[model samples]
Target: MSTASTKKPPEVRLPPKPDLELRLDKFAQLATIFLSLVGLLFVLKTGSFLLAPVSLAIVVGLMLAPVALRLEDIGLPPSLSAAAVVLIFVLVTGSIAAAIAAPLASWAARVPQIWNELQLQLQLTSFSEPLATIRSVREEIRNVTGEPNVTVSVQDGSPVESVAVLAPALLAQVLIFFASLYFFVATRHDTRLAILKMCSGRRIRWRAAHVFRDVEGLVSNYLLSIAIINIGLGVTVAVVLWLLNVPSAPLWGAIAGVLNFFIYIGPALMAVILLGVGLASFDGMPGILLPPLAYLALNAIEAQIVTPMTIGKRMTLNPFIIFLAVAFWLWIWGPVGGFIAIPALLILFALARNLIPGFPWGMPEERRRRLSRLP
Candidate 1:
């Protein structure tokens, strides 16, 4: 009976193993990064109304920084210089818009004619049967559902009404853009100093300074060079189109130039637009093909030869990476996102290379070594 009363002690539970703890810590870090990225994307999309214009202003400010600094060097105050720069930019943009307006208005006035032409041309193709079948099916479905065709009359949703609704927001964004540009320009130097001063250590401060320098140099040079290249490309497009008797040659050229900024998507869109232009202008195959084909040839030359020469090897970025960046930004912010994508990538790359010692993933070996050697 005494022996039977004896009982075993309870087993002890040991703490988690070191390896398990390490894995959990790593997972927590990953989770934090993922959450941060998600939050950032959410903020960018939701706050696009403010963020988009500010982003654009910052890019524009960087492009014009050299001009602002030059003005300051010539004894103009930062405020005055910023104002002058902004005014000049507005004038240039307005001039371009004005140059485009008359042609655009004329073309818009001919939309019905173009639509008819497009329909006729499409009917002449193999797609006619498929399109007709789809239309018939749609009509049958509408009938079955007892749904009348929706028509937007002037009272319902006129362009004027739409513009009136949107104008205030547009005006506000414009004001925000201008104000952001002015302030960024005025405070550029002070901003740099302030950032550098906030660094915790000498090495970190040095890296930060280089990051700023690299960002300013790369962005400004890339933008300025691109601007020059696009102007040339635009002029070339205008002359070629004019020679081909394409209507609104200057307008198309200007559109081409502006679109060229978006890289792959832009050129492809321009081609589609030119195809539409071709269909609108000409009745025969040669006429229809000439505009797009000629533009393609010119674009090929510019992209392959002139652009590389102008921007230089140092400014070159991976095409795939550029496309991805453009896609991501465009998805988030529409056209403004597309406009800022390249600059944003450049800025990110500069920061990464300066701040991280082994960030040579996309860099050339020599360049990576060079960057690694930096303090």
Candidate 2:
């Protein structure tokens, strides 16, 4: 038998290929893009809730990290050390609030009275004389031209109602701030370690370390300098108000100091408040003019001399960028956003320096030279 024609038909075979692998790779890329877009949208939409507490926490943590480290050096466990830091923060904040609370309340009560007094002062001032002349001119024109009947519309709302609405918002903000601070203090080490682990390669690791160190130094220094400057501002404002015989001088001063955190806008708002107070309490242009003048002088000194000296080139950011950051955050999250803008900018600059090699801004030439020189 011819092997009984048992020769089997040639077995069929398929070519080996990498279609599955390619498909998987494409899917992963798509997934990554999708996730990133989702994250970005979430941040843009709900940023106000996340940004405020996060910014406050970061600031608080930066300010307290040294203290926590010191406590650790003295043999305290990390958790205890963190707790101690939180306690200290709470106590300091509480004491400051307590110290200012009564005076602020008193000032709040006196605002309406002050407003009335300020109106009277404005009526008597040299500035008011121009208004009187304008009125006379208008009357003469009306008399000669023959007056036409005019009607006015008024909207009615009580100021107290506005205050009532604001109170809850303020309280909620305070609550969020404190809670965030506590959590930041408690988790700072974990956060740092996680960030470090996320980095790969020796150069990346070193860059991360450098960037974090710079952030720590810059934020701590900035906060300390701000605290000192604000205290001085508050004291100066209080002294001036007292000398000028303004009621609740300390309260106004404290307000000025606190608001100064928001930079140009804060001072402008405070100027309006001071102008109103002057109109209520004093009797002429001097009253209105003096507050604005005093604020201008103090701010000029702070901006030109004290800030430059204390902050130095280490943290110098472009003024235009700073202003835009302020505006952006203010638009996104209002006053709290403005307060956090500088520190947020610092964090952003630091991250960019690390993540994006050879970024143009914020890379100090001298520092590079020194680094290059090091063995």
Top TM-score hit: 1
Residue 86 of model 2: what lDDT?
79
TM-score for each candidate, following the candidate numbering? 0.83, 0.72
- lDDT score of residue 213 within candidate 1: 80
Q: Write the per-residue lDDT of candidate 2 for residues 214-285, one digit (tens) a residue.
A: 788778887888888888988998898888788778888988888888866788898888877766666667
- In model 1, the clashing pairs are none
Q: What is the Cα root-mean-square deviation between model 2 and the actual structure? A: 9.0
lDDT of 1 by residue, 135-177 (tens): 9999999999999999976557788998999999999999999
Error of 2 at 181 (Å): 1.7
Which clashing pairs does model 2 show?
114-280, 117-279, 117-280, 118-279, 118-280
Candidate 2 ranges beyond 4 A from true positions: 1-42, 125-173, 242-251, 360-375
